[model samples]
Target: MEGADWLRTRLTSLHCATCGRSYRDGQIRVRAQRDGLSFVDFVCRACGREANAIVTVVGRGRAARLEVGELAESPPGARSPSLGPADVLAMRRFLRRFNGDFRSLFGADGRAGGRLGA
Candidate 1:
């Protein structure tokens, strides 16, 4: 998928570091300043504090990591994408539905299948 869509699909809301309040995807403004990454700016609605975030593309799957920091930093080459509350919930649901079926969970053509000589 294209950079903008990829970013939008992977990014969820981030919580306020100071107040522990959460902000939605639409409430925050994100800009793709780099190649396939995004520079996210989050403004806390309650306390009016702003946070700088970076979203980077990692592996082949539809996963991306959202890193929130006080200032923008160079993207780390490859790291597990950060999970928001929504992502965690979705993962729980996936595990529930695909219980014990590793192939179904990771895909039959996934690396795990290939590695196991399946």
Candidate 2:
């Protein structure tokens, strides 16, 4: 998490996979991360099942900023940054509602189509 403070700001909520308890920053442990993605693990204080995430940044601004906080870049077109803070906020909202399914999330109108589905 040396260079992932900006990412920390965006991930405002995390849910436990074991007992469905909401997670806090102090409970999260960063396993690894790159420019636009991160692999993290957190233990559920309620039931002890570890929760993991491969956090992806597709929003805007710092999501496109270099890992070291604007220290360098690969030229303009090389990176495709989104519009603005609104985009980032939208993505955060999406992640907060993530149900851990790709088909339900992207296969049909990008939504959960049924009860107990993502």
Q: Which of the numbered candidates is closest to the native, going by highest lDDT? A: 1
Cα lDDT of model 1 overall?
0.59
Cα RMSD to native, each candidate?
Answer: 16.3, 18.9
Model 2 regions lying over 4 Å from their true place? 1-3, 62-118
**Each model's TM-score, in the order given?**
0.44, 0.43
Error at 74, model 2, angstroms: 35
Residue pairs with clashing backbones, model 2: none
lDDT of 1 by residue, 47-95 (tens): 7666667666555454545544454322333223578999999989976
Instruction: Say which candidate scores most in TM-score.
Output: 1
Model 1 RMSD in Å is 16.3
